[model samples]
Target chain A: MKKSLEGRVAIVTGGGGGIGGEVSKWLAKEGAAVVVNDVGSDLSGGGFSSTPADGIVSEIIGSGGDAVANYDSVAQPDGAKRIVNAAMSMFGRLDIVCHAAGIVRDRMVFNMLEEEWDDVINVHLYGALNIVAEAVPIMKSQSYGRIILFSSVSALGNLGQCNYSAAKGGQIGIVQGLADELKVDNITINAVFPGADTRMTEGMSSTARAYIEQWGVSAESSDAQGIRSSVRNAPKVAYLCTEAAANITGQVIGVFGPPMTVYSQRVLMRKLYKSNAWQFDDLDFAIGSSLNRNIPESRLGGKYEQR
Target chain B: MGDRFRGKVALVTGEDHDLIKEISTLFASEGAAIVANCSHSEWVERMVSEINAVDGVAKVGHFDLTSMADAESLLNFTVDSFGKVDVFVSGIEIRDGGSVLDSVPEKWDEIIRPVMKNVFATTKYVSAHMRTQNSGQIVNIIRDKKIHHDISVTNSIITEAIIGFTRTTALDMEKYGVGCNAVISDHARNAALVSAYICSNLVTPGISSIFRVDEQEVSLYSVPAIERGIYSSDIFSVDELNYLVPKYLFDGEELS
Candidate 1:
């Protein structure tokens, strides 16, 4: 295939390893000047180091691709601005942004602390906005940009991940609103919900792991078999960051081993009985009818299984 | 001759009698197994039987755009018959004619209930199977203009809603390789239904001027029997729609 992103400038947050590292490499290999921004924090979104980011930057430079490392946390507005500035200062312009920096605080709603929610939201949702606000003005000046935000299947409402879900869900809303505002400016914004073997989900509860394993799936750490699956699911993130997706905006696509499904949050089938005035009995009937209409053997319920 | 979708199952809906029939027959000729054909009227049944008689695989299914249950069943029947749904085409028109004040609530619902709502229902359900298989294409036939000059404001609103829904779903499902796009057709074929209230009446002098008709004298000097004006055809050809639909879906690539 032709180099889809030749001469493009990309900024990938959390570019040390996992999805961010792979995305950073892919963009560089496709001829992009990639700015690898990572604070080297763990999956919970804390800590800092230049090792991981710098290592990836060296790897790209060694391979004759343009890249630089920036140790900046995406959680703060100033940190986000500095990352964008690094991209412009190093590459001269920014054309693509893959906001893959995020953290997971796995706690059920009852046990979820306020700090847990705030931290997750700060790094994923607000961090996304901070970066976008700084990047969009430059993109608007150029009149060409592609933004790939990371959402999760968890946003479909995962258990023991209320904070993560809230942050990821908020990312979807932000993408939709921003896409509408930027459509006339020739900028397209989209999100990818990837299913791959990453450091984040490696420690799933035995019960959940068992269920996934029973489906003939193993943890992505399982030798070559697991690595192959991870690679297959990873390219989609790169594809979304390419120029061919110009007409596509405000979308959330799921990327698994081989299957890629377009998930939709749609209005359920509604039932309205003919009436100008309503009563308790009418309310009961309407609720019952709405439930029945909504709950058929449809994909909405299938794609999102309730725990 | 090159049947990329050969041995695959395809489903089509709506009421472009000539266009749907032709497209369905073409897919069958290209080796696709026509799983189910649905329409809002009985006339579609007659067309289905004609395709079946020619040994082009097909089954008739009830489809009323107003009913989501029927829309769901249309998809279920396709999976039940062929065990998979490889392609889906929606070619229905559900908009009623009238200006803002003249258009009633019931009429607005009549138009939107099928075209917009039904398409949403189908995309939501059919995509479930495609996602599992990691492959599928959905083509929705939309009009070039949201309002056809004479229709009410509701038409534009409904059209916008569907387009928004399509864009959102397209992004969400890219990982599964499922593609979604709408084909925008021109206005000639459906003009009679929208002429009076939407477009100015094709006859009245100033009203004719609104549609850019030239001035003509009606007097004793005029001939007793004279042709008034020419009628324009706004309906797009099947070839044009087919080409455009895939272009939108694959981002200008011929490959599905």
Candidate 2:
């Protein structure tokens, strides 16, 4: 029996550890020649080591999968091009590019340093652009490609993660806006909000941990040995890179747990219709009484719920 | 002059010449001391002169919002010029548009650097002041002109970032009696009016919502939420998911 991706070639950025590593291994196991690219940067995207990429490549090859290691940072355009070039040089073709590279510098919006903001944006948002900029042209020329950006649930907005949320949120915009242009060329791009416990989550503050707990879904790290492991997210991510997923483009999918989640794009929830411009008193009354009925009154303002 | 903002001070920042002019003049007319900011000083100086000519107290801030020192200085100038800043309106216009495939790393820097640096730095400094003062209104207005057939990948990306920043900032500053919200106007139509309303006392604090302003109507954007889900005893195969996802999740119909 021929494997689904027997002749395919894949480039998995940040494939050294965690969810990205698992996805690289899964793709290789399914018969795709893999280029496992990792800068081996720390959680905040500083420092680099070739050991992480080399180790993952060895693991894949030992498991009877064809693989090579590429230690190029995706934060720069030149680095991104070299990553794509590695696939073409060794494997001769590129079919799948999964960008799971990311970093974090969590801070309250007020106290966030300029460097902190720049570093996070450079890694997550600019890194995505660098990879996609190089890979898309190749994919477009070949008339076949599958690209997946590892977005986060934080894109919706998380406390103390303004930079991260903004970067992740921008990824959503890329997938949404680019879906139309890429689909015609047979290249599909989507964002996966992988919910996994990893090094990223291990450093969660007590407040952040409590917030996650309040949501009733405890995150399990990809390295954990269990059915609830973050490794479970790998299969879904890998599946998106398969030829079978050609129909899916410009979609935001979440891989967290018992159920995979599908999110909708920005849509109008409610409206205040008017022919003439809104007067303060009238607009205030309409929004307060009707639009804000469901919102719980906060310490700042809004109508308190009548118990 | 109207007494709506008789004793208040407002700072306005953006690249759109007309929108900034309209907003600055409107706030000044409402009796608020104005700080009109831009990268270039000449136009802003002229706007400030016109406001002062009309007996409206106004100042010009030509510093870069992307710089921390400049951001702090801008805020300091506002305090030193007027007593303090009570309202902030950010009308930064996003002009980048192209397909993701056609975009480059430099384009990303060009488009994102200004928006992120300006918005984040300005909000950081301004919110620090507002937090101490125990009262302020911060409204970020994003303007984009959607070109038909252009993918607008960078534009959409920056827009979402701003929106997300607004919500996160709102949470951080809410307890301090500071309100943060975002207004997304595709055409810059009626942005000044809507922004003024957001700064008004009628708007409730701790309410961080995105409003899409158009020529005539204003619509509230729903927070992006999971509209559907597919649960299986185990993760389904590509074949199973390829069939079930659309039927159950994307079709806008209930699953059995």
In model 2, state the lDDT of residue A66: 97
TM-score of 1: 0.53
Q: Poorest 10 consecutive residues of model 1 chain A by lDDT? A: A298-307
Candidate 1 residue-wise lDDT, A19-58, digit = tens:
7887788778777889999999877877777898998888
TM-score of chain B of 1: 0.64
Expressed as tens digits, the lDDT of each residue in B1-256 for candidate 1 is: 3253568787876666654665566566556677445554576677767777876777676766445466568778888988898777665454544332244334534554345446655665676677788877665555443222332333433443444344334434556766554333433222211111111111111000011100111000100011111111222222332343235423454221
Fraction of reference contacts reproduced per prediction? 0.00, 0.65
DockQ in order: 0.01, 0.53
Chain A accuracy of model 2 expressed as TM-score:
0.90
